[model samples]
Target: MAKKTTQATPKAAENEQQSATAQKPHILPDRVWLVLARRAYEEPLRQVGTVEADDIELARVYARSIYDEFAWVEMALVPRETLVTVIEA
Candidate 1:
């Protein structure tokens, strides 16, 4: 007895490739922005949340919209990639 093999049709193969591509995670530049907020001028800025955006404008909008739980007097967005880990515990 011989083993049987089946071949996929061109259309079905294309569809399978497309579905595989869709299922794979997209490769995008590091766009994670760390959201920092301060309750008062004297208070130190604390990490509140993070947002992913392609640009600073979008990051600003996302940070404001997503982290609206508190009425922070000052809010800032810093690119996570630029942050240098001084000490890692």
Candidate 2:
């Protein structure tokens, strides 16, 4: 009689996958800022005015630093490759 080989059960495979996933660092998604801004906005819009702040460039700098800080965990990432479309009727 020939001996049969057994593969790892699904549960074992799943556990191995989970452990591997836990070892990686977190990835900051592109929408991360939008989400952060939304949460920030939750606190009443302070200094509401027509004046614009030149913070976009500053934010880009911060984002670059943040990206290097967390470059592992995988998640839905959005790249700023196109202009945001505003649909107004």
Supply candidate 2's per-residue lDDT for 37: 19
lDDT by candidate, in order shown: 0.90, 0.42
Top TM-score model? 1
**Model 1 lDDT tens row, 1-89:** 89898899999999999999998868665489999999898999999989999889989989999999878999999988898989986
Residue pairs of candidate 1 with colliding backbone atoms: none
Over 4 Å off, model 1: 1-30
Candidate 2 residue spans exceeding 4 A from truth: 27-89
Candidate 1 to native Cα RMSD, angstroms: 4.2
lDDT for position 13 in model 2:
100
Query: Which candidate's lDDT is highest?
Result: 1
Report residue 23 deviation for candidate 1 (angstroms). Answer: 4.8
75 in model 1: Cα distance from truth in Å?
A: 0.3
RMSD to true structure for each model, in Å: 4.2, 15.5
> lDDT by residue for model 2 over 6-87, one digit each (tens)?
9999999999999998877465432323202112423532211121113555445554444443332321223333328789
